[model samples]
Target: MIEVRDLTKRYGAERAVDRISFTVAPGEVLGFLGPNGAGKSTTMKVITGYLPPTEGTVLVDGLDVRRDALEIRRRIGYLPEHTPLYPDMPVSEYLAFVAAMRGIDASARASRTEAVVTRCGLADVLPKRIETLSKGYRQRVGLAQALIHDPEILVLDEPTTGLDPNQIVEIRELIRAIGREKTVILSTHILPEVQASCDRVLIIHRGRIVADGTPDDLQSRFSGLRRLSFGVRGPADRVAEVLSARTDLRIADVSDLDGETLFQLESDADTDARPLLFRLAVEEGWELTELHRDRANLEDVFRSLTSA
Candidate 1:
């Protein structure tokens, strides 16, 4: 539903986004992740027609963003990091105003406003002025306006920022539900948020995409080596000797703890050494107690990609 081709954004001599290309399919929720100044927001701005790219092109549902800015905006519901809202307007009144701006007819404004109010959980705060609402309610109001027009795509930046845990979870659930029908590009630095709500992840760094794939895929790609940990009750020297004789396993660490020998094994390939280890222990009269493989997670992958 969205395609960005070799997109770049520059300010004076510095490039905020450099030759980045990616596509989002319909009904896909893409998590855009990056450290501060990694160009995540800059990319989103270009995609939503808020900022024009210095080079390359962006297409939304086959329409060029530059030439069809108005049409693209009509199909996109965007909640920027700093949500633009009329502080003095009541929640319902604000949504109605947004509906008008989106070109919704007067006859359909009330029902549209009510639908967004219900979807974003703004019923109790309908009569309250935006300025009088809490941060969570204010966020709800921002989301309500974004959805009041019922657009086909949603570009949300930091949608859960400043909300309490409960409010964050509520907003996450709402976004997940919305993703069931519309294409969503969620820009945030929260790793767990992506794991909890996004289908795929794009990690940007230094104005370029450093990683792109499902969270599990990226984890596997950059996980480097696998580590096998085991605890066996035996003579530490004898156990070490047997493990060292194997050409497949590279012993990373070995220590004697209590009455057992703990071994940390490493291998470049994704080989399962547990079965071999059990067989060796039985033949050597060693009592095997604990055996497991330690796999890399999303956080590990993120740190490896972004770390200097």
Candidate 2:
């Protein structure tokens, strides 16, 4: 577990991380979200003991980050946004080197390297040079290096930044699997990734904590703001009248689209106006074409909290 108490970090006269406090329970996967220069990376560095806090304290497993910096580093695995990889080195050699650097004994270094290679799915590219691999493979290599020592907590920055959709899903599932037993703090701009992989979300803005909760919990804050749109081959006036009669749905907009009338309706997040609209279309003999739903997601919550 990790605890940050009024932690502050500054660069010269500018404050990178303002007074912020939070706790990460054991076995929790926390998603860290923020815009550029929002103190996310700074806080992560302080927690990992890569940077000293200007004020307050960070405790990892009851050990002070400032006092036990080396010991804390041993307990945490960090993959920065830009992975420090030697392009000329082969994947196998790089992993082995990292294991040794992490203080794994000569007897255990090979097995440690093997375990991470398997866990990170690097079997095929072990012999290839780091520069020869694609972005996704390089990321896998970075992750494998981070896991070489089997640290208790994992801190990943922009883990899936350049991956394709399929690769993203693969990495997301891999992170989910790792989160089952190890505490993970993932920092990325991919909101959907957080929704899919993280147990809870922590949003920081302007060097402070703005929002913290499960994806659903944050989305609930914007309930009743969801929009449902429909395209019907019927009179717009009649459709509006019928839908307006229902108190549960508010007709936000009515427009004439290509060959049909588009009706935009707003309703609570818990309410489903689709069923009743389908019934009305059937009873009124209206031909329904498009039925699309738009609801508040993690991105919405992030924008609302972080935007200036």
Q: Write the per-residue lDDT of candidate 2 for residues 1-308, one digit (tens) a residue.
A: 89999999999999999999999999999999889788889999999899999999999999999899999999999998877689999999998888878899999888888898899999999999999998888889999988889989999988988889988888888889999999999998878888888889888898999898888788877443667888899877888888889888898787887769988888877777788888899999999987878644776678878876
TM-scores of the candidates are 0.80, 0.87
Off by over 4 Å in 2: 227-265, 286-296
- What's the true lDDT of residue 242 in model 2? 89
How high is the lDDT of residue 93 in model 1? 78
* Segments of candidate 1 deviating more than 4 angstroms: 225-296
lDDT of 1 by residue, 119-224 (tens): 9889998889999998888887888888888999999998887789998998899999999998899988888888888889999998999999997677678876
Compute the lDDT for candidate 1.
0.87
Choose the strongest candidate by lDDT. 2
CA lDDT of each candidate?
0.87, 0.88
The superposed Cα distance between candidate 2 and the true structure at residue 196, in angstroms, equals 1.2
**Predicted structure with the largest TM-score when compared to the true one:** 2
